[model samples]
Target: MAEQINLDKDDLITFFIHHLDKVYSAKSHLLKRLPEILYQVHFSDLEEAIFETIKVVELQRKRMAAIYELMGALKNEGSISGLTGLIDDSFEEIKTHQDNPELRDMSILFYMTNIEATEIASFQVLQLLAVKIRKERIKELIKENYNEAKADKALMLLITTKYLSTV
Candidate 1:
C-alpha cells in the first residue's frame, strides 16, 4: 500500500512549484532530443514544422523559468517519471522504425503530441492552483502556456492527418 499525504494551501503552492520544475526539466530534455529526432526525419516539410515548434518550445521554457523565478523557486529537484518513461519509449519506437521513413516521422509526431497533451494537462492544474492562491501573474502565465500547448497539439494533429493521408 502507498502512503497518502495531505497538503494545505502553502504546501499546494510548493507542490505546484515542484511540478513546474519537472515540466522545465522535461522541456529541457526535449530541447536536447529534438535535433536528434530531426536528424532522423526525412521529410523536409515535417522537418521544418518540427524546427518551428522547437522554437516555440524554447520560448515556452523561458516563460516557465520566469514563472519559477516569480515564485521564488530556484531548484528543480523532482523528476516527472511518466515523461521520462514516455521519452524512453518514444526513442525505442523510433529505433524500431528507423528503416521506415514514414513510420519514423509519424512516430516522432505522435511522441510530440503526447508531450504537448501532458504539458496542457499540467498547465491546467497549475492554472487552477494559481487562481486558488491568488497568484494572478502565475495564473496568466499558465493560461498562456496552456494555450500554446493546445495549439501545438492541434498543429501536430493536422500534420499527422495530412501526412498519413498522403502516405
Candidate 2:
C-alpha cells in the first residue's frame, strides 16, 4: 500500500499537535514541580538554560499551532520546508546538558518530544521517499518505544512521589 501526501498542512499540523500537546501538558506539570525536586541541586547559573528551554518549547508550540494557517500562505509555507531546523533546534536544546543523570533524563525527555514531532513529519517523507515502507514495521517500532517510555514514566512518578512525600 502507498500513502500519498498531497501537502495538507492542516492534517500534518493536527497530527503533530496531538502528540506535542500531550508533551506540553506533561512538561508543564513537571516544570511546576521542578523546584521541589531540585531544591538541593544548584540552579543559579542553570536558570538561563531553563529559560532558554522554556522559550524554545513555547515557540515550538506556537509553530505547531501556526502550521495550519501557514499551509496556504507563501511566506508562512516556508515553515514546512524548515522542518529540519526545528529538529536541529530540538537537538541543540538538549546539547547544553553534560553527563549528570538528572540532566540526562531531562535531555531524553526533550528528545522524546522531538521524536514525536519527527514521527509525525516523517509520515509525509515516508510517503514520498519510500512508499513501500511497511506500516506494520513502523507501528511495531513505535509501540516498542512507547511501552518503554510508559514504564519509565511510571517509575519516575513513583520516585518523584516518594521524594516529595519525604520533603
Candidate 3:
C-alpha cells in the first residue's frame, strides 16, 4: 500500500545513463590496467589475444562515446564498477605467481575470462535498458558491444582450454 512512484522514459533514460557510466568506468580501468597484465603474460598466443582485447576495448570505448554523444549525456567521470575488484584480484594473483611464468599465465587467462564475463553481464543489462528505452540506434550499439564482449569471452574460454590441455 505504499505510494507508487510513476516513472517515465526520462527516468528510464537516467537509469540507462547510469549503467552506461558503469561500463565506461570499467573500460577506462581496463585500458589502464590491461597493458600491465599483458606485460606479465609469457605465452605468445595469450599475448596476441590480450593485445586484441585491448584494441577491442578501445573500439568499445569509442562506441560508448558515440552513444553518450547521441544521448546528450556526459560520461560520468567518478563512476566505479565491480570490475575494479576483479582486476585488483588479478593483480594479486600475478603477484602471487611472480616467479612462475606458467602459473602466471594461467592466472592471467583466468582473470581475463572473468573480466570478459563481467563485461558481458553489464552489456546484457545495458541491452535490456536500451530496449526498454526504445531507441533503435542505441539498441544497435548496445547489441554490437554486447556481441563483441560475448565473442571475447568465448575466445578467452577457448584459449583457456588450449592452455590447460598442455598441462
Best TM-score among the predictions, by candidate number: 3
CA lDDT, candidate 3, residue 158? 90
Q: What would the per-residue lDDT of candidate 1 be over residues 76-100, giving only the tens digit for each residue?
A: 7456476655766777777788889
lDDT, candidate 1, equals 0.82
**Cα shift from native, residue 132, model 2 (Å):** 12
How many clashes (backbone atoms < 3 Å, residues ≥3 apart in a chain or on different chains) does model 2 have? 0
lDDT of 3: 0.85
Q: Give a tens-digit lDDT track for model 3, residues 56-166.
A: 999999999999999999998544436666777777777798899999998888888888888889989888888888888988998899999999889888988998898
Name the candidate, 1 or 3, with the larger TM-score value.
3
* Model 1 regions more than 4 Å off: 1-7
Candidate 2, residues 59-93: lDDT per residue as tens digits?
Answer: 44444344323333222222322443454554455
Question: Which whole-number lDDT from 0 to 100 does residue 84 have in model 1?
Answer: 59
Error of 1 at 95 (Å): 1.8
lDDT of 1 at 95: 78
Q: Model 2 — TM-score against the truth?
A: 0.29
